[model samples]
Structure formats: C-alpha cells, structure tokens
Target: MKLPSPVQWIEAQRKRGHELCLMLDTFDHKPVLQTLLKDRTHDRYSSLYSQTPIAELAGIGPFLIMLDSGDTQPLTELLNSPERHWGWLVSIAAQDFPALVQHWRERILVGQRPDQGIYRFHDNRVLGRALSSMPPEARPAYLGPAHSVCYAQGEHWLSADNRAPGQHPLPEQPHWLQVPVPPEQRARIRETNAHRFLLAHHQVAYLQLAEHRDPFDWLRLQRGRAEGWGWHAPRQLEFLLVSSLSTPEFEIPMQWHPRVYEEPSEHFERVCQEAKLLQGKGIA
Candidate 1:
C-alpha cells in the first residue's frame, strides 16, 4: 500500500479510536525521580535529559532533558541571584503514560496567570521558583499531577495546574509526588518548568504561549517554515522521527541497512525529481 502523509497517518491513528493505557508499575516511592531531583543544584545541572541514565524510563526520551549547559548556567545564575527576570514552571508526562493503549487526546489546555513571565528554558526564573517552592529535598511539597504518577499504580495525576481544565488529559497514575512547599509557589514552579523543558527537548524552539509542551513542535515548525530558524530537511526529519518514535505509533525497526553503492542510477535521479526534493540526493 502507498504510505499516506505522516500527518495523515497520525490522524488515522486517532480515528482508529481508543488506545489502551495499562498501569505498569506505580512506585509509591519515586526512587528514580527522587534520585534525579537530589542536589538539583544549578552548578551541576545539564539541560539535556537524555544524558541521565534513567530519564527515558519515565517517558521523557533522550533529548527531553537536553538543555544547553551554558544557557542553563545563566538560568542557574538567575535562581542564585537576587533579582530574576524569568518565572518558572515544570511538569512530567509519566502520570498519564499508558502501558498498553488509550485514545490519543488532541486538545490541550494551557493555564497562565496575568503576571507570570514566559521563561523558556533553564533560566533564573525557574530556579528562583524552584528555590522558593520546593523543600529541602528539592521536591515539590504538595501532591500534584506530576507527583501523583510516582506515588500510585492505577491512573492518576502527577503534575498539572488548575488551568489545564479538560483538554483530553493524559490519563492518570497512582501516587503523587509530595513536595514540602508553600501553596502560593507551587503553580509557578510547575508552569515554568513545563515551558523550559519543552523548549530544550521538543523539536520546536518557538513556543505559542500555551501551557502544553508539544513534542512535535519541530515537525510543525519545519513544515510551516518558522522564521529566524534555519533547519535542513535532514535535521528536521531526524528530530521528528526520533520524537515520534519515542511515543511510537508503530514499532521501530531493529536494524539499519546502508546502501551498497555510493551513487544512484537513472531510476534514483528520476525519483528525486518526481519527489520535488533536492538536498540529500547525492546518491543520484
């Protein structure tokens, strides 16, 4: 069968209807998350989440935690400094993760306060919030959607603010991540972290001021040709394929096969032209 467009394939999946999300293991005790959050000192932090040995186990994928160390250092500085320009928020998708299957939720509800500033990634704003809200353990004090995923088994919430009312929620988890924090700063930390983490990991660099972290921002950006952004099709494809594969719609192939010959014959040349694409056609 001829393959449909990638977007079409995704749409088809959605149309196919319900997806199953079975609860895998809901650790009442979040050993991994706790370990990672430990000593979240700005000095030792790296923007790239993939670098962590355990990041992917929580469904964040390789680049999800990816942050520019230098850029991030500034954010650390922001947190450590007296007056910070940015504000912070953070969240995790593990709580909504489904082991088996479930219907994909398309709607996203982003909540923001009038005064909250949009701080992109590892910035002073977020660290300041973390510092203000999280307790000595560097964990969120109250049980949030983000924290809930770590605490229990069946579907529940780990992290998420009141803003995202019901835009097709990411299911639920069992337990909650309990942080020792004041009620006022909790929302700030969760919201700010969400923006920065998505900017670092997801394909798209420009955010829409929404609270949701879109994993496919890169693909949409490339297809839409976002301004002030230079991206080669190869790099764009790499990002999209990798991100999509993480929360895969289809199973991934086990092996890679390189072409035996360096150059492409007449057939290849014709195919390239017919496809109306030019960059990576050295084979032809």
Candidate 2:
C-alpha cells in the first residue's frame, strides 16, 4: 500500500481546518533551528525544556512549533530539507498552544511515582512504536488535544487518530504516571536502541550481522548471552552486543570483566580492542 508523504498529509490536514504543528526532537540539529527561529519570531514555538526544572538545557531540548502549512520551506531548509528533521507531525482541531504545551509537559516524565524518568515520546521512532504498543483506553492521555499524530517509518508514514474526540484534561502539575510498557514493547524498545547504537558505532558489522539474522533476534540472543555472563548493567550489555557484532562468538575474558563495584568503561575499551584484533586476524 502506498503511504502519503509528509507534504501530502499536511495538505490534507490543512484542508480539514486542522492546525498543523511539529513536535521536534532537536538533539541533532539544535544550532540550525536556533538560527532559523531567530528570523521568524512571529511563528509560535515553545521549547519543552523552557520554564521546566531543567530550563538551563532548553536550547537542546525538543520543541513544539506551529507549522505554516503554506510556508514550511524556511524551517525545513535550515537543515537542508524537511526530510532531515527528527519529529512527528501533530494535527489539532483546536489551536490552543498553551494547552498543547501542558499536554506534552505532563508526558515528559513517565513510570511509577518516585521512580519516574524522562520519556522521549517526541522522537518519531519511539512515538510510532510506543503508540502501537499502548492499549486503546490509554491513548487519550498521550493523544490529548491532537486530532491525529503522524510519523514516518522508513519509506512509510504511520499515524494514530484520536478516537475519543474530546480533549483529555491536563493535571495542575505535570503528571508522572506509570505508562504500562508490556514485555514485548520492552524488547522492541531495547531492539531499537541496540540497532541505533550499532548503526552509529558499527555500521559495517551491523550490515553483515543483518544479512545473517534479523537485528531484533540477534539482539535478544546477544542479550541472553550477556545475562548468562551475569552482566545486567546497560553499559555491560551494550559492550557485549557491540563485540558480538564484529566477532560473532567473542566473549569477554573472565579476568578482564569488571567487578560489581567497577564501571564498565575501562573493560569496554579492553574488550573492544581485543575484538578488533581478533576480527582483523579472522580468529574470533
């Protein structure tokens, strides 16, 4: 099935009297946006980080910017084009920016009380998967105010529409509730993270590994091996996975493995060097 491109989708939304906006994850192009928005101060944009406890980091945080459907070229051109931006499109029936900002602020922190953590729902990669995994009843809180949310996955654009219609109320304080992430969702998130890591740090190895086995299955298998080795920390598991990518059967020398009290940085470097040496000689 053919999926509509971003511009096509935006045009359709505009015709429906829906307000077009973007929830940008600016981690990669903070400077580019900073410069672009300076000349276009009339365009409404709210940094999710501003006025929050972490206000100092506002410059690098995600932004909720209203998109001028007729004129998106300026913002899109800053980083070469719209295709390079990392965010999802939001279509809202009501154009209340303050309400929209509060809606997202409430979602910034997730998980149960006392153990709450930052939720990167702004990232299109994470948003698409997270929304799919959520139950029908649980979606309203996340989809508040927005009539529909759309994101791109590979060459296809995927979206979720607000089925309930009415706006979900925002709390007086930014709410931090436990958003249920099922076991399969957890595995999917882990798989995505691992694949992103491999692509960034071990592109050739990731390509070779993908040709043999699916990245998710390989990650699950590698994760099991890491757990079997009693390595539970994220850093330790990542080190094991990266090593396995270059040298499929590589194992951390028992003596070189970090102890419970030690950090994995030193051990990661040692194991990675050993893996590289073995890969060079075809001995791993």
Candidate 3:
C-alpha cells in the first residue's frame, strides 16, 4: 500500500492537536530543552528521565533521546551532572520508561549469539536485504554494506572473547545457509524505508512525539536514517519539519524547500517562517 505523503501525515496529526516545528542542530536548543524540563506548567506533557544506557533503550519506545556523545564523560555522570545540556520531554501518557528497560533486558537475553556477544539489530541480515531492495536512487543514501548478505551478518554477529565451559570456539559455531529476519526487524525495515524516503525525497524528518509502549511498534517508527541531512531530534513531536543542511537545486517549487543557512539560528528562523507560510496556505 502507498503510504500517506509527509504533509498528509503531518496534517492528520495536527488535527489531533499536536503542534509540529523544526529546528536545525538540536544541540543549539539545549538551553531551551533544559528550560522546558524545569517548567512543568504544561499540563499536556511531562518529562521523563532515566539513568539507563541508551543502547539498551533503543527500540523500546517512540521517544528519541539525543545525547552529546561529543563529551567524553561517562553517560551516568553526564546524565546527572548539573552541566547536562539536553533534557527529555516526554508525554504524560507515554511514561513507559521502566517497561522499556525491562523490554531491553529481555531482548539482550534473546539476541545473544551462543558464543558471540549481543547481536546488533542494525547490522541484521534483513536490513541488508531491505537496503538492497531499495531503488538505485535511494540506495546510496543509506550507508553500510548492502551488497553481500554474508558481510552484513558477519557485522552483526559479535563473537565472544572467551568461550565458556562446554562451549565451542566462535569459529566452530553452527553455520546457517540463511539467517531469517526477525518479524520485529522486518517491520523496522519497512517503517525505516518509509522514513528514509521521506527524508531523502521529501527532505523531512520524523521524531517520536509520544511514547510507543510496545517495543516492536517503537522500533518500526524510528527515522533510522544514519547519515545525511544531519538527522536529529529534540523532543515533543513524532515528525518534525523537513529541512536539509545543504540546499538542493529543484526544478519545481517544493512545498518544503531545502535551503542552506549560515547558522542554526537562521535555519530555525527559516523553519518557523516556512511553517507559518504553510499554515497560512492551509497546506497542513
């Protein structure tokens, strides 16, 4: 089935009372987010904080947590430190933080590869297949191995450093002709493709506004775009404004045209301007 256009999706969401806005380089808005987290007057939503590792939280919920990995400090220290730059603004109904931790714990156990360490979901063989299946124009946008199936699987399979008692060496582990994509991963691949197309073609980004409680559902909706267009999310909206770092030359007037700005402030100003224009035109 053909999916709804990004604008159509945004309009459907707006009707439900959600406000969407786009900002460039979410890192620039760290102070604004910190303020939002401190003020709880907004009855519509509540902020959630967690000390858990982000990797474990991945695929757990619809919430996107942007961290400044540029800081070399430990994550725990970074989370509680007064200097903590970004804050998480989550919906009140979407407070599934504890459940997300539990889900990740379970997933860790299930994804363990006998002698190998944890299986990296992104490196799954199914993802490779999905990438290969995309049209040539869209395929190059996704970085990583897409040609050889074995290479992709090898990337995900983390061999144990030392074998446990009674366990065979990593090289001796049973080899399979094909590794089927888990049902959850399949759904992620599909949704990821949809989001990727939106970013690459429509030049829009989708952020997780509310908490998707189900791990499977949450995994499916993530933008999943690793590179290009400088993809990042602050909080509050599932899909944010579509903007690009480098403006593209387009023959037709795009509903949301990409433009380059000297600074993030300029980019954000342009985003707001464009949003207002679109609203005035009744586009969404």
Candidate 4:
C-alpha cells in the first residue's frame, strides 16, 4: 500500500478526531549542528550509532512541516541527510504521547523481561497430556477446552487470579485452559518476538539519548548484544521504525507464555487513576 505523506496522514487522523503530533530532527542551521557536535565531543564518547546524531531533537519541541503535492525534496532530504540523523517520524496522538513516554521511561528504570509470558498453542491432546504430567502448581492457569474465537477473552481469564467455568465450560476444571489461541496467534507471536527484541536492544539507548546523556558506549554494548544473538542491525532498525510510531490504527502485537500475566504497560493503572482524579476534581 502507498503510504500518505506524514502531514497528510496526520491531517486525516485529526479529521477523524485524533489529536496528533509529529516529531522529527531539525538541525536546519550550521550553528545548531556546531553546538551539537561540540557537546558530543565534550562528552568524550566514541562509537556513536547513526541514530544518536539526532539525539538532541527529542528534547526540543516537534517540527510541524508542511508538504505539497510533488514536493518530495524535503522528505527525501530528511531521510537521506548524512549530516542530520532522524529517528522514526513518530506521529503520536497528543493524549497518548505522554503516557507512551512514561511507559518507556518506566521500562528503562526497571529492566523489562521481553519473553515473560510467551506461549505456543497446542492441540487438545498435546496440552492435556502436558497438563496431566505436570504438578498442580506448575500447570498453567485457566485450563479448559479450546474455543473457536475466544483467545482474547481467554487472556482475560488467564490474567485473573480466580476464574470459574461458565455455562458452556470446557472439560478441564479450570475453564481457562480450554480457551484456544487462534491460529493467527502464531504469526502474531513471531511478529511480537521480532518487535520486542528490537525494543529491548535499543530502548535504554534511546532513553539515554532523549535525556541528552552520553549514550555512545551504551549503544555499542547493545549492538554487541544484538549481534551476539544473531540479529542484523538493518533489520532491527526497520522494526524500530514500526514499533516506535503510535498512530491510531497501530497495535503492539503480543506473545503468549507461561509466566504470571501482567498488562504490558506498567503505568496503565496509575495513568487511569490520575485521569479519574482529574475528572473528579473538574466535576466537583
């Protein structure tokens, strides 16, 4: 599919009631570039990654560039400039931008477990045999027969501490075990693994850059770790572009696993509470 220009895409989303903002690097002047270079040298860092060149851009306000039909030069310049580095042209809704940043910051503060709850779907016989062989404590939560279209609903049950079988329950005592993952879940898992791997490798480095800290060393370490795991830098960059953008239609794919389930966003509950408190204060 041919993608719309960034401005056109954002405008269309706004017309649909999505309040969005665009973030891109803008070192349009030599003075700004000189200052950034001086700061970078003073920090005494070597082996800086390509993306690190535009690290300062995250601290400043976003640039709202206008585009015209057949006006591809600016976009091309932004993408191909050797002197200027740009991360993904992230177009996030205004409301979600803060929450998303907070989420990434929290992830950095407390290191994340990328493979926490990944699970592979199996046929009834296979799952049943595995469950029968395992002890009660080791068995997965919410065991029941498989359903045609209940993987998402089943996730709710799996996350809950206490769950019971409903009217049309599966054979197993815990109803959740019977909930079958959709066939497409496998593809989603692979996509999610690729996404998380990229994020896990670069998130801390990105966060450091955002804070205007010296992240060259950190970026080097991450690069080595990623290489050790047999990941290609170019492929990782492609994943980062997609994963970092928070447009209305984008969904962060997830994987299923055997760990205790928690909602991916660590600050979701806190953000909800703060919103409610503000709403209540307004009402009063």
Could you tell me the lDDT of residue 196 within candidate 2? 59
- 1 or 2: which has the higher TM-score? 2
User: What lDDT is reached at residue 135 by model 4?
Assistant: 55
Between candidates 1 and 3, name the one with more favorable lDDT. Answer: 3
| Best candidate (score: lDDT) | 2
Per-residue lDDT over 17-73 for candidate 2, one digit per residue giving the tens place of the 0 to 100 score: 888777887767776456546645644788997887545556667898776644456
Which digits, one per residue and each the tens of the lDDT, describe model 1 over residues 146-215?
2211111112112222222122333232111122435444444433333334545552532432234453
Give the total clashing residue pairs for model 2: 0
For model 4, the superposed segments whose C-alpha errors exceed 4 Å read 1-8, 23-85, 109-284
Q: lDDT of model 1 at residue 96? A: 33
Off by over 4 Å in 3: 1-261
Candidate 1 vs. truth: CA RMSD?
Answer: 21.3
Per-candidate TM-scores read: 0.19, 0.57, 0.23, 0.23
Best candidate (score: TM-score): 2
| Clashes per candidate (backbone, < 3 Å) | 54, 0, 3, 12
lDDT of 1 at 14: 32
Per-model RMSD to reference: 21.3, 9.8, 21.8, 22.4
Our tally of clashes for model 4 stands at 12
Superposed by TM-score, candidate 4 places the C-alpha of residue 114 at a distance from the truth, in angstroms, of: 17
